[model samples]
Target: MLATGLTFVAMNGIVRHLGTGLPAAENAFLRFAFGLPLFLPTLIPALRRGFPRDLWAGFALRGALHCLGVIGWFYAMAHISLAEVTAIGYVNPVLVTIGAALLMGERLSWRRMVAIGVALVGMLIVLRPGLRALGSGHLAQLCAAAMFAASYLIAKRLVERTSPAVAVAMMTATVTLALAPIAAAVWVPPEPWHYRWLLLAAGMGSLGHYFMARAFAVAPMTVTQPVTFLQLIWASLLGTIVFGDQVDLFVILGGGLMIGAVSYITWREAARRSPITPPIDVAKGA
Candidate 1:
């Protein structure tokens, strides 16, 4: 989990470094496109076996939603401070809980409701509407979180019918295909240096996902989920030291609240032996 947090933060730092030189769609396309090669080993076998035809629509839908989320995340990286983006993203697990109840028919207990409410309050603290202006970047992150949550709910269903590798490979391929035309429509010729950084970002993103999966496999979500809070701390420090972004106390406090709420939800689900809400790693869109 620590490695997962570090690699993801490093990937975000690279995206922040890239800024808005390329369109967000193009940037998102290139990141996934470059990462696609890393999955070829898994993709080849999965292709040879052939995918279950019934699951194609699910994969396509998930790809489209995740593609949009990636575009929004890239745009947010360019527009907002890393700390703000990271803090806002902590709301994803909460969003996933709501999505699971609405779309998957999961029961919403009173305790879960309270946790969700706390998460909403935490989110409002970070955004602080009325007290301060909300920018497009802030709105984009919130939308991205919803898209990511929806994608995750779909993934839970798909995973029941297929292997994790096949699911992941198909998602990467579908998202790459989905992003291509959008990238081309708004394409800007990237500098040679952009390719180098984006490739590195792709590598780090893949590594982060791999580490997160491993962490989940070895430890319970209840144990692993809380450790992810370190990511906000890392993001805050990195934003301040490297990018000169101001360290907002409200962002930190709110993020902590959200993380606490998420951790409680995970513990409850684990204790009940119900369908555990997917971890916030979906925020990384593995």
Candidate 2:
């Protein structure tokens, strides 16, 4: 999980660097395009084993949600500091909690509701709505978080019926195809050198998620999920070193509140679900 957090921050830095030149839509499309080859080995085996035909549509929908998240995330990265983007993104798990309640018929407890409220307060503090105007970047990140939450929920459902490898592979392929037309429409052919950067970003993202999946596979969510808070610190450090962005205390404070809320909610849910069975961890930004 620590490695996953570091790699995810690294990937975000690369995205910010690349997005300075590339259209976000094109960048998103390229991410999945280049990353698809990495998943081919896993995807091929899953294809041979086969899953219900009905689930393909769910995968496609999840892919589309992922595409939206990617587009918004890339756009946000280009326009905002890495720390700011990372902090606002912590709301994802909160949103995911709500989604599970609504979609999966999980019981919504008062503790979870209060945690969600606290998270929203933290978000407002980070945004400082009345004090400073919200930038498009902030709005985009918020939208991206919600989209990611939705994608996570759908992926969770799909995972019940199929392997994680298959869910991931289908999402990659579907997102690549879905975004291709838009990417091509606005696509400025990147310099030959840029492909190297894209490949690096893709590699980091793929490996990060792979490690994250492995961590969750081996450990309980109660143990693994809390470690994801390290991502905000990593993002803050990377922003300072790589991008020369200052670490905003407000962002840290706000993100800390959200992380605490998420952690508590996750623990509560895990305890409620089963004392014996390990709970599934929430997906983090990649």
Residues 4-118, model 2: lDDT tens digits: 8888888998898876698999998888899999999988887787766689789889889989998999999999999999988877766776777787776566876897799
Tell me the number of clashing residue pairs for each predicted model.
0, 0
**Candidate 1 lDDT over residue span 1-286, tens digit each:** 7897899899999999999889999999999999889989978887787766778889999999999999999999999999999988877766766776777676777877887799789889999999999998998998898887778677667665665555666778899999999999999999999999999998898767656555543333334545666788899999999999988999988988987886787677678887544444433233
Candidate 2 scores a C-alpha RMSD against the true structure in Å of 4.1
List runs of model 1 lying over 4 Å from the truth: 1-3, 105-109, 211-227, 264-286
Candidate 1 — what's its lDDT? 0.81
Q: Tell me the alpha-carbon RMSD of every candidate.
A: 4.6, 4.1
Off by over 4 Å in 2: 212-226, 263-276, 279-286
lDDT score, candidate 2 = 0.80
TM for every model, in the order presented, reads 0.85, 0.87
